[model samples]
Target chain A: METMLRKREDKIAIIGAGTIGLSFAALHLLKHPTCSIAIYDTRPDVHDYVAEYMSKTLAGAGVDIDSTMQRLRISAYLQEAVLDAVIVQEQGPENLDFKITTWAEIERYAPKTALFWSSTSGIPASQQSRNMQDKTRLLVVHPYNPPHIMPLLEVVPSPRTSQAVIDETLEYWRGIGRTPVVIKKECTGFVANRLAFALFREACSLVTQGVIDVKDLDEVVQNSMGPRWTVAGPFKSYHAGGGDGGLKSFLNKIGGTVQQCWDASEKDVKKGSIAVGEDWQIEVCRQTDEAYGVVDTRERDTRTRSVLEAVSCEEEVQ
Target chain B: METMLRKREDKIAIIGAGTIGLSFAALHLLKHPTCSIAIYDTRPDVHDYVAEYMSKTLAGAGVDIDSTMQRLRISAYLQEAVLDAVIVQEQGPENLDFKITTWAEIERYAPKTALFWSSTSGIPASQQSRNMQDKTRLLVVHPYNPPHIMPLLEVVPSPRTSQAVIDETLEYWRGIGRTPVVIKKECTGFVANRLAFALFREACSLVTQGVIDVKDLDEVVQNSMGPRWTVAGPFKSYHAGGGDGGLKSFLNKIGGTVQQCWDASEKDVKKGSIAVGEDWQIEVCRQTDEAYGVVDTRERDTRTRSVLEAVSCEEEVQ
Candidate 1:
């Protein structure tokens, strides 16, 4: 694992230069400065957009735009893009048919040893590669929004995925400064999205119950658990809660309270369920846009990068 | 609201100088430098412990210890603590009988205008103030653990709580550089804990189901959704997901996927439910302690403070 991680200069192929694909391109350049990236997007204009996006996003992280761009190759043909690739990251649309088609193309052209990684957030790789000739190297490598900044990468493997592929994928992501967690079993939404949606359900329930307004609910999270989770995960946080006794003491003292909270949560979920009504959703979207529209994206990205940098610098110093 | 926020020098009383109470005292001193504090605890040595804790914690936040300590008064008697107080924050143990006894004593001594705030996480303010003569002034002002650093304060009011008290409490918290979200109706766990427990259930389910190791699970959250949430809440994040159309577009495209994830989550919950088994919890605590022991608390607090300070500074500039 250590040796694999030390080898950072892998020939990477990025298929489908959409929003996620573009973000991955920037992330690869910023994280693996020595690696070369080949971007294959069906659209002719994807190269220019990716170039501009990478320059804007990576420049803030201190990446030299011209030199980094020199190592990037934009190919309109799939064979030309992935023929010599060591890792093929497919960030195509979420549709199964489109994914199967893209996977077949990559498997046909890319080197047999190259790992076939999908950026599908929800779909399992097994289903996406069902029609492919070989599926052992195919797996899901889902990332959260703005992959260049967020360090979480869910390296989910299908049943047929080989041990070497999993190990190499993990090593590569770690080498690129990503915190990759392997999903032992294939599950919908994986870990991050499942946890995210769980919280989202309750946030919606609170809004419906008038427990808090949309804006204030956001504030509550941003101020408290947001930073808390950033420093310590839930289990670690509870462990800290127990003083010297650790999680055992915390559970003994407050386990009943957690159960009670869960029980009460069921009632709240029913009482003030998140309405999927179009008008209600539009209103929420309007309010959300009003609060954090596109104009604030640059500021938000900058802040997230600053926090990550601070945390990483602290870790290095320690 | 703006004018009320300007008044910072309130005479405050903190009953029960335990962990939470001491934290509240430190927070008040750090945030409101001019406010005088009176602390009441049954334990005779609480003053020394609180003083040591405050001195150690506040020094990291660049607070002037000597000046802050001069305004702090430790009292063994309840009357002495609440006699002339304008705000009395009660952080007693989670016992109804004991809380009633303490509240009765506080009401008997504290001035009529003093706002009665309970730091109880589970019990509602209404239930706590059931035995009090004047319930109108009572409310719940629950803070996340280590109140001096984490900025979330759930300002939940009982039905009998006066509007003036609510408004003043909001203004006061904001004045102290805290983000307080008002809970419109009394509910168990309120918003933050409900959201927290919601995520915890899934986390436990994942661990139990062999989906991810406890350490890896923590890494997944600490790296991905944790920081993403610190910058933008769920609603706002989804808004960004939908290119220019905002959250409406995001929902329109992926609402069905969200529902599917929720459905899959229900099955997963039943498969690997969070067990409060004593031995299992102990093992988890041990691992957690090994990963993030007491020595790391200072580093954790420093990192959290850095993130909060950076965020607040950005907000001010915006």
Candidate 2:
């Protein structure tokens, strides 16, 4: 009986069973085969929802369906779900009041050692940590839509989140095959969404301004920057674009041009442009600013090159 | 002898054998085995450069080295190169004056029916079509970068460019394995770069503002939108994000939130933001607009899903 039941420390509590919550549960169940998941939600059909989801996706991957389903426990009571959870992942509604009340409640039931993770895309950990007794372990571990399928897990910590908890967060995500990047500060929209919305703003302007239509704009991106950025980020891409001189050369030659293009965009459309002066360009172009990892731009052995090659090669096959 | 010499109309002349010109030449040689290539450049080491490039790449692809080399013709005189050509791709210096004079000269020699393509990333077709007697056939057919490897070819037509030439340009590029999008009007930075710069600006702001350092920002992007965009463009991604409601639903629910996020970023950073009012959002949220192609967002079967699945699956493998 002892062998049949999962360990006490292996208890993972998931609050809320929405799309993101279900996906996160599925990810944990699929990736960490040995762990047990206790999901708590106010919805009457939470069990049916989980069962239906598992039925649909369980066949795709090589995960042990029956065992995974057996490992999952559905609970109506929040305290019962989080009683001994080693990790508490809340995927509740994006409402701040819901999160504040929920986290304060969770703090009372969850074990002292449990780390709290909120899947909110916008609301920061600081806002959610209002009534919590242990704010150090509370942080935003936002996933790019459909966490089960996406690779990015943005680990954003509030100002009060301790370094040890941050390290623990990183280790947990890394252990689960997630590419987690620690955002230094808790900004609106974090990092990925900010960059995405920024590009999207320009895309909207291009279409409305009649330079190109929405469909063609999408086609251009799917072909061009789509593959380019997939492998390398903007810095690495431009660094290589500079030829031998790297990012510095690229900035020296094209920063002015980028700035000019921005000015043109500004004149025609209201979508804002970033300052692309040598100083600003130089600032972001740094290869070694102490982040998670750094790919040497000179080697150009990035996923960008491989993805582009693969894309074109696939085209050749077609 | 006629077979060995190749046909007159099959002659594709590439003007200026610089990095891009050489890549264009290589792309033509490798992709179109039946067509003969005539490369014109003022460089003394043009032959050596071409030979070295061909040797390095030809082996990796299954293209016959001798056959591809046999179809190649390198010349010092531009007139001799373009005299019998049906297509002339100019990869000259990015100088307006240079393009103006070069097109004027090529106009005098090349066949009147020959379609002229300038691989200028920024200089618009309308601007470069100056000083040419036949502006109808000349337009900017810009490639993303490294024309031989990348897939996107931006086919931007000048206002005076004939409908026939635009069709011919599309046909020529599609015939060779390039995804060519038609830009309705010439704008600075064209489409891809403007979208790229817009994103880059926000990325710089995030770094300079200390929300995320340069390296982590790149990491977050490389993991998130990098793979996301590689599969589907922004509209499709957002459309899917809206779930069954489609793009309209997405704009209805998130457009206001996005607009708010932009305003917040604006308060902190000077980089521009586009209006996300329901009216403007409706304009670009359109998926069926008259463009080259349209992916039905309601289906939610765009490249975004496949790319994300693939990216995560690859992680599983690793």
Candidate 3:
């Protein structure tokens, strides 16, 4: 296993070149230029394809990544990926067995102190690291869809996971200009998805029950609290609802109503299966399909690239 | 039911001066120098106290509503509040019984064609106007909390509700510099809340099941999707996710993954009651409490008011 010819300055091994992984790779290469990155994948073609694509993508976006691209080598072999890397980002198949095998492989090939960060959404860090020899190094660093554009990364650690790994991981993410929220303990789906899914479920239930049409529902959120959620979270949102004193006042006044409503919400959410029926439901599906069809991702990607290029590095520090 | 004279050019009436009503009145008066709003509440003391406190609060915030305050009236009588009003913004109770009774009272005293908008979160326009002779005259115009800050409003109409009512209501909201999304059909919780609640339900479920802590969950969203959501909706978000062609590719490739995740999400959400047993969970709650409590609504309200004030009222004509 031959390592990439680059000086190890916080060496990072990216274990996959999927959407999130590639985004992180590009961002790391651009933002943390000092860090050495080697992408490892089971797919023989992914490494070369992603490397070439990112170089062209960045070059087109006017980002200077020629030297960084030179430093970024793809390793088809696991041992090469682990040789000098201090932090290993795993974006492998979502299958449990694949993860277990990957964990074993990381143990065998990676440095003793290297932290393993899985990008799994639902599979808990505890569950993933159960069979590992040194489970303390394992944690989930789950990023939303496009890791570069979206700043949040959920860092969920098992009970046995070390504080050193958490702190190091936090610094690594922050150094690359990513906002990382550390989960104090291991939990299924960690944070973002749990909150997101909760929202999705209620939306689905409403549509299923013929409450608001899909388009209208989407409009409602986009116009209303969605904008609020942009700047603040649910708690802050509800706090405003309380007026001058904040959430305590809000709860004191309307907490009973919310609690009562919360109790009623249980019976309302008809679970099991995506219940698709009615003309309106089909219309929503069709409309989404049509509207989505009109979207151009390359254009968006280019726009993002152009925007990133136009703005100074310091502008994005926030 | 004696009607009052038009005290000034900027005189307006805000009926049902509760949380929603007072917020609207305070916001409208603070932002726009063109009008002074008179808030009317059935509870005489509430009307007087709110009017007095809000005036002082506004004055403290450096917004001179003194001239507006001179025009401000605290009326216990609906007739007195509605007289000579260009528009009537009603934030009555959501209960169908209470609303119907209030509307009947307002109808007897007010002019036949005063643009009446209801700030009901739930209870559709159809049900609210089922007993009214002139059902087409009324429409449900729901706004997010701290209406001064949030520009989104759902202009929901009943099946029998006229398109004219919808257009007129939208204009009234637009006159106040609100972003209105007209919902053609009336449903439970209108648009924003239904979708918001859906997300809330799934979020609460995830929290209850110990999938994620409340604070970590909020951080992930606030930093990640929340920012994008500020600019675009889920469809646009996914459209960019597709990378090349757009949403078509996302739906074709990762759409299955989303559907699969959605399917699994059904079972994961815990039904009924939230029990926080873990020490980390208690810490999570405390963090959430502290975070929410620290948010200064006065600052937020001021920003909103300034934005509203900045909007060129003449641009609205074009």
Top TM-score prediction, candidate number: 1
State interface RMSD in Å for all models: 2.1, 14.4, 5.7
Model with the higher TM-score, candidate 2 or 3: 2
How do the residues A268-293 of candidate 2 rate in per-residue lDDT, one tens digit apiece? 55542332221221222221122103
Candidates 1 and 3 compared: the better one by lDDT is 1
Output the number of the DockQ-best candidate.
1
DockQ of 3: 0.29
lDDT of 3 at B299: 56
Question: Measured against the native two-chain assembly using Cα atoms, what DockQ does each of the candidate structures obtain, in the order listed?
Answer: 0.60, 0.26, 0.29
TM-score of the A-chain for all models:
0.91, 0.82, 0.82
Better of 1 and 2 by lDDT: 1
Evaluated at residue B234, the lDDT of candidate 3 is 60
Put down candidate 1 lDDT per residue, B79-186, tens digits, no spaces: 998988888999889998888788877888899988899999878877878778988889999999888889889999999999999998988888777888898888
**Model 2 stretches astray by more than 4 angstroms:** A1-9, A271-318, B1-9, B271-318
At residue A310, candidate 3 shows an lDDT of: 24
For model 1, the docking class works out as medium
True contacts kept of 3: 0.35
User: Candidate 2 clashing pairs?
Assistant: A231-A303, A231-A304, A272-B272, A272-B273, A273-B272
Query: By summed lDDT, which 10 consecutive residues of candidate 3 chain A come out lowest?
Result: A305-314
**Residue A3 displacement in candidate 1 (angstroms):** 8.7
Task: Give per-residue CA lDDT, model 3, range B95-139, as digits (tens).
Answer: 889888777776666777676778887767777776677888777
| lDDT by residue (tens digit), candidate 1, A221-267 | 88888888887888888877887877777888888888887787777
